[model samples]
Every structure is written in C-alpha cells, then in structure tokens.
Target chain A: MRSQSRIAFYLLLTPLVLWLGLLIVIPHIDMLLISLRERISFGVYDRSLLQYEKALTEPLYLRTFARTAVMSILATAITLIIAFPVAYYIAKMAKGRLQQVLFLLCLIPFYVSELVRTFGWMILLRETGIVSNLLQWTGLADQPVELLYTDATMMVGLVYTSMLFMVVPLVTTLESLDDSVIEAGYDLGGNGFSVLREIIIPHAMPGIVSGCIVVFMLSLGNYLTPTMLGGKDSLWFTEMIYNQFIVRSNWELGAAFGFMLLVLSSVIVWGMLALTGRTLKETMG
Target chain B: MIPTIPTSRAFRLTYGAYVALFFLYLALPLTVVAVFAFNDSQFPSLPWDGFTWAWFFGTERPQIGVFHERGILRAVGTSAFVAGCVAVLSVAVGTTNAFLFNRYEFRGKGLLYVLMLLPLVIPGIVLGISILIFSSTLANGIWDLAQMDIQALRPGLLLVILGQFSFITTIATLVISARLQKFDRTLEEAALNLGADRLTAVRTITLPFLAPAMVGAVVVAFLMSFENFNTTLMLVGSDAPLTIAMFDRLKEGSTPLLNAVSLLLMLGSSLLALLVILFQRRP
Candidate 1:
C-alpha cells in the first residue's frame, strides 16, 4: 500500500518535474551559458564576460537600464499613492454593495488586454487625440501638445497600467485589518492622521511592500506601454533588448540584458523582503 | 471586520470625491476604447466624430471592421487554439503538481517548489528569449539523430505555448494548493477505508474537491495565455496572436477597427469572468 502511494506520488510528480525542468530550468541555464559566451565565427564561440562588459560599458544600454529602473520606481510610488485612497475606501469605508461595485470597477479593466489598455491611452494622449481635442475646443493652446513620446506620458502610462496590481494587494491587506483597531486609536484621542500613521500604515505595510515589488517588477519589465506611449524616444531597456534580439540578431547581448533584468528584479525583491520582514511566501501573493 | 472605519465628515467627503476620481481614472480609458468602436471617424482618435457601426460592420470598406480583416481573424483563431491547448495542458500538469507538493514530503522538495515559482517572477520577455534559445539549440543537436523537423521545435506557437505554460502552471498550482491546504485529509482516508483503492479514493474524493479551483485555473490560464504579448512576441515567428497582430497594425497606423477588436476582447473576457464567478457561486 505504501509502495503504491509512493508510485502514485512519483507518477504525478513526473509532469511537474518534466515541465519545469525542461521548459524553465534548462532554458534559464542555457541562457546563462549563452550570456557568458561571445560569438567568434558563424557557429563558433569563445567564453568571455564580453557580453556583460559590453552591456555595462555601452552608454545606451547602461543608460536605458538606469532609466527603466528609475521610471519603474517612480511608477510604483505613484501607483501606490493613487491606489491607496481607493483601496482604503473600498476595504475600510464603503458598505457591502457599494464596496463590491467599487472593487468590480477596478477589476473590470483587467479583463481587457494590456495592449488594449495601452492603446486606449494612445487614443487619449496622442497629438490629435481626445485630450488634445478637448484642449483645442477650450482654446487652451493654439497647437496641440505632443503628449505621446514624452517622459511624462510614459509616467502616466506606467502608473495607469500598474494601478490595479497595487490596488488589489492593498485592498487584500486592508480588508484583513480589524476595524476596531483603527477605532481604538481614534477613541484614544487620535485624529485621522494619527490613526492612519499608528494603525493603518503598519497593518498595510506587507501589502504595500508586496504591491510595490509587484508593480516595480511589472513596470520595469513592461515593454509595450513605454514603447507605445513614449514612442521612439521611450528609451526603455526592454526595447534595447528587443532591438538586440530581433533587429540586430545579437542574442548574446540580449541574453545578458535579460539576465541583468532578472538579477535586478530579484535583488530588489529580496531587498524589499528584507526591509519589510515578510517571507517570500507571505509577500508573493 | 472590514467596514466601519472611524472618520470625520470632512474625511468622508474627501475620501468619497477621491474614490470617484480614482474610478474615473480606471474606467475612462476603457470607456474611450468602447466608445471609439462606434466612432464614424477614419482614425481611432477622438472628438467623437459622430456615431457609426462602420468599424463593427460596413460594406463601403470591409477591412475597416476588425471582423472583416483577414489577418486579425487569423490571429484570433490562432490565439484561441493555442490558448485552449495551453489551458488544458497547464491545468493537468499544474493540478497534479499541486497535489504532489501539498501532500508529500521529500528531499529537495522545498528547493523544487521554489524552482517551480521562478517563472512567475521572471519577465515574460526573458522567459521567451530563454526558451527560444534553449529549444532551438536543443533541437539542433537532437534533430539529425531524432529525424524531427526543426521548425516544429523552433520559435512559434509551440514555443509560445511552452513559454506561457511555464508561468501559468505556477499560478494554477498556487491557486490549487491554496484550496488543497484547506481540504481535510480525512475525506480521502474515508474513501480508502470504505474499500476504495488509492486511485478511486482520489477520483471520487480529491478530484471532486479540486474541481472549482481547476475551473478558475482554466479561465485564468486561458486569459493569460490569450492576452500574452511579451513572451509571444519573443517566441512568435511566422504566425501572430491577436495582441501581436493588433500591435503591429497599431504601429503602422490603425483605424477604429482595432478599437472594435479591443471592445470585442473586453466583452469576451468579461463574459468568461462572469461565467467563472457564477459557476463558482453555484452549489
């Protein structure tokens, strides 16, 4: 009977081990090797840190990587600022039906593709788009502003795209907070601000940290939003990687860039976990 | 436990206004997409150029409607087929994984579990690149001996499905394992004691309990696979998915027809989500 159970366990385990091992682990290992090697001739290669060296030394690659990191951090921060009030309202303040509806409002947009959502922003922020048209009608400017292909536009797109991720985690954490805890703070002559600082922020810290991590990773890795919103001048790192792989066919450089992204995101996530004192299991969801 | 926060009238009013604005921020862009689907304008952009169904259906220019566009339709079909395969394959493997990891204790189990989740944290673009590089290279060595077609193992729908499956299966496992953690072990034990063998115990007890989570996994996995663009872009070669096709068109310049497609995608996904919610709620 024990042997039968053991056989069943190994049998069930086969699919997972095969899938993850072949598809995920092996590929990543191959990528690491590819990232390490330099192509010498048509099919020949030499082992070197040249790929990493080139990526690090090259001004365009390094600059875009930095830019992507900064932009993602800024986007994460802004998303948190925008998401907090709404999450607070839904999780803590709103009544049953209203809360569900408000929550649904946040969720329904996620039903649409990120491509579609970003496309909608293009329609709104383009030179002849909705905002420009409104400005023209109101006589705000003689010429329509070039809202697309601007850094501010990238910021707006990033924040907009990442809002739901931040909000959901915030809502989840905030929903678990006991109302009496906040009321206790309030009853002890604590004003709203004091209660917020004393009770609410502490309770929501794990959510905030986790949400920030998720948003940061997404915004950093995001290719389409920046490319669409910021156009040619987007200067996102993923675009650099894309150019390397497809246009340039420089897989080595692209692999290095991809590895760099993996490292950067992992390091940041680790830092966040350390700072917040939350386990990976606790924070990942 | 969630409701009844202590708040002043001033805070209440302010919070209410902020919430309204926040909802607007979330809903307005989506609303714009839907509204432009009906716009009579040649361009997808705005000033609400009178209402028309030309983008949805019109004889004057058939290609102006997304459904009329051949490339877009082909992509839609490809996306559906790939997503269907991915959903089925991922759920089967993912559910089995959930049970294995949840019910067992073994050497390197913790390490293996962490490794399983690596795909979730990895960027889709990277996943695609890695898988593309890995598979083609692996196939290069094996093809001569195995006498298999290289294109089949190359970057395309098969690679796209594999790339998506890596991360998606992790999600399914997480969702299922969460459900599994809440399950009582005694139910399976109860079946076994009543003369059912191990397989029968599982089929009658464990599998039935996991059905709801498996259903949710199907929808979520299907949507993720369908909506995926990053991994698909890296791995896709000749054949295009809807997101990739639409993005290519948008880059060249698009019409309200793209908006129509966006609206259609929204409607389809919303219906799926609604079905999942209702199905889950049913006793």
Candidate 2:
C-alpha cells in the first residue's frame, strides 16, 4: 500500500515537473544563455556582455527602463489610493445585499478583456471621443481635445486597469479584520484617522503589499495600455523589447532587456516584501 | 454593518458620493463601449448619433457588422479553440499539481512551490519572448543537427496555447489547491477502509469533492486564456486571436464593428462569470 501510494505520488509529480521544468525553467535558462551571447557574424555568436552594455548605456533604452519603472511604481501607488476606500466600504460598511451587489459590480468590468477596456478608454478619451465632446459642449475647451495619447492618460488607464487587483486583495485582508479591533480603537479615544493609521493599516499591510506587488508587476509589464493610449511617444520598456525582438530581429538584445526587467522587477518585489516584513508564503497563502 | 466611529452627516454624504463616483468610474468606460456598438455613425465615438443595429446585424458595405466580418468571426473562433484547449490542459495539470502539493510530503517542496508561483510575478511579455527564443533555437538546432523539420516548435497557435498555459496553470493550481486544502481527508480514508481501492476511492469520493474547484478553474482558465494578449502577442504566428485581431485593426483605426465585438465579448464573459457564481452557490 505504501509502495502504491508512492507510485501515485511520483505519477502526480511528473506533470508538474515537466510543466515547470520544460516550460518555465529550461526556457528561462535558454534565454539567459541567449542573452549572454553576441552575434559576431551571420549565424555565428560569441559569449559577451555586449547586450547588457547596450541596455545600460543606450540613452533610449536606459531612459525607457527608468521611465517604465517609475511609471509602474506611480501606477501601483495610485491604484492603492483609489482602491483602499472602495475596498474599505465593501469590507466594513456595506450590508449583505449591498455588499454583494457592489462586489459584483466591481468584478463586472474585469470580466471583459483588457483590450476592450483599453479600447473603451480610447472611445472616451479620443479627440472625437465622448469626454472630448462633452468638454467642448460644456465650453471647457475651445476645440475638440485629443486625450488619447499622453502620460497622464496612460496613467489613468493603468490605474483603471489595475485597480481591481488591488481591491480584491485589500478586500480579502480587510474582511478578515475583526470589527471589534476597530471598535476598540474608537472606544479608546482614537479618532478615525488615528484608528486607520494605527489599526487598519497594520491589519491591511499584507493585502497592500501583495496588491502593490501585483499591480506594479502588471503595470511594468503592460504593453497595451501604454502603447495604445500613449501612442508614439509612450517609450514603454516592453515596446522596446518588442521592437528588438520583432522589428530589429535582435533576439539577443531583447533577451538581455527581458532579463534585466525580470531581475529589476524581482528586486523591487523583494524590497517591498522586506520593507513590509512579509514573506511570499505569508502574503500569497 | 456597524461603523467603527460616529460619523457626521457631512462625512456620511461625502463617503456616499465617493462610493458612487467609484462605481461610476468603473462602469462608465464599459458602458460607453457597449453603447457605442449601436451608434449609427462610422466611429465608435460620440455626437449622440441615432441608434442602429448596424454594427451587429448590418450586412451593408461601409458598416459591416461583426458577424458579417469574416476576419473577426474567424479570429473569435480561433480564440475560442485556443482557449478551450488551454482550459483543458491547464485544469488537468493544475489538478495534478494540487494533489501533488496537498497529498505528498517531499524534499525541496517549498522551493518547488515557490518556483511554481514565480510565473505570477514574471512579466507576460518576458514569458512570451523567452519561450519564443527557446523553442525556435531548439527547432533550429534540431534542423541543423538532424536535418529534420519540427513545425510545432515554431511560432503558431500551438505555441500561443503553450505560452498562455505556462502562467495560467499556476493560477489553476492555486485555485484548485485552495479547495483541496479545505477537503476532509477522512472521507477518502473511509472509502479506503470500506474496501474501495485507491483509484476507486479517488474517482468516486475525491473527484466529486474536487469537481466544483476543477470547474471553477476551467472557467477562470478559459477566460484568462481568451483575454490573454501580452504573451499571445509574442508567440502568435499567422493566425491571430481576437485580441491580436482587434489590436491590429485598432492600429489601422477601426469602426464600431470593433465596439460590437467588445460588447459581445463582455456579454459572453459576464454570462460565464454569472454561471461560475451560480455554480459555486450550489451546495
């Protein structure tokens, strides 16, 4: 019986091992090796750090990398700020029916594709779009305002896209907080701000950290929102990676840029985890 | 619900307004997308044009409906096929992963578990390009060394499904494992002790218990695979999925037919979500 159970275990283990190893692990290692090489001639390569050097030195790539990191961080922060109160209202304020309805409403937009959502934003923000038309009708502008392609527009789209992720985690964590804890703070002469700062924030830290990590990763890696909304001047890092791989056919440089993105994003995540004193298991589980 | 602190009328009104504004923000863009699908004008944007069913049902030129657009319809079919294949593969493997993690105590389990979650943080674009490079290089190496051609390794629908599968399986495993963790081991043990063999016990007792989670995982996986853009964009070859098709069209500037497709996608996915919620409510 023990032997049989062991056999079953190994059988179950095989698929996971293959799935993770062949698909995730081996491919990444292959990418790393590819990133470490430079093309000396047609179909001939030499081991070098030229790709990394280019990524670090090229003004376009460097600025784009920094810009992407900063924008993603900003987007994460904005998403948290926007999501917190809504999550709070859902978790603590709303009654059962209202809570369910609101939660479902929160989930409705996410059911659609990101492309659709981004397109929706385009429809609302374009020069001939709804918001621009409303602005002109309201005399807010002299002529139709083109809002489709700007950093601010991109930021709004990113925040809109990532808010639900932040809200879900925040709601999960906030819902678990015992109400009496907050009541205790209030009863102990704590004002709303004090109660939130001292009790609620601490309780929601895990959710906040996890949500930030997810939102940041998503915003950093996002290709669509920035590209479509920000247009030609978007300067998104993923676009650079895309351009390298597809347009320039520089897989080696693309691999290096991709690796740098992986490493840097991981570092930021690790830093957040460390800063908040949370482990992966704690937040994820 | 009880308030943590006493709130003034002004504070209460302010909070209420904020909540209303939040929902409006969430709903407005989607509402615009759905509403504009019926717009009589050439564009998906405004001037409050008269409503028409042209984007969905019109067979006329210059206002071709989504159903009449062969490219969009074919792309939708392609997306559905890829999503279906990905859902099955992800859930099947994800179920195994859940069982592996929940049932066995093995060395390096923690490390393996962490590695499984690594895909969650990795950029989808990176996942796409890495797999592209790895597979193409392997295909090229095989061709050079053995003088044989392997088509599956190249960029295509198969690769797109594989690319989406890489991260999606992780999600499926997470969902299934959450359900499995709450399962009562004694039920399976009782079956084993009552003369049922292991396979029979799992099939009858354990499988039924996991059925809901597996089903939920399927819908989640299917939606994720369907909605996936970043990873699919890199891995897709000649055949474009719906997202890719929409993206290409949008780049060239499109009409309300795109909006029509968006509305349809929204309706389809909302129905799926409603079904999952209803399914989960069943005892």
TM-scores of all predicted structures: 0.97, 0.99
Which fraction of the native contacts appears in each prediction? 0.72, 0.79
lDDT of 1 by residue, B1-283 (tens): 1346444778677777888988888888898989989988778776667988887776566435765777888999999999999999999998899989888999989788878777777878888899988987878878768977678788788898988888899998888888888899898888889999888888989899989999999999999999998889999979999999999999999788899999999999999999999999989
- Residue A111 shift from truth in candidate 1, angstroms: 1.0
Give the distance in Å from residue A217's predicted Cα in candidate 1 to where it truly belongs: 1.2
Q: What is the lDDT of candidate 1?
A: 0.87
**Model 2 segments more than 4 A misplaced:** B1-4
Q: Candidate 2 lDDT, tens digit per residue, B1-283?
A: 2464678989888888999999999998999999999999988877768999999988999988988999999999999999999999999999999999999999999999998899999999999998999899889999999998999999999999999999999999999999999999999999989999999999999889999999999999999999999999999999999999999999999799998999999999999988998999999
Scored by TM against the true chain B, the candidates give 0.94, 0.98
Residue-level lDDT of model 1, residues A1-285, one tens digit each, is 799888988998899889988998889889999999999998899999999999999888888888888888889999998899889889987878998988988998888899999998999888888888888889997888768888898888889887888999999999998878877887798877788888899999988998998899889889898889886766888888889899999999899999999899999888888987887777763
lDDT of each: 0.87, 0.93
Model-by-model DockQ, in order: 0.67, 0.77
Name the runs in model 1 displaced over 4 angstroms: B1-8, B143-149
TM-score of 1: 0.97
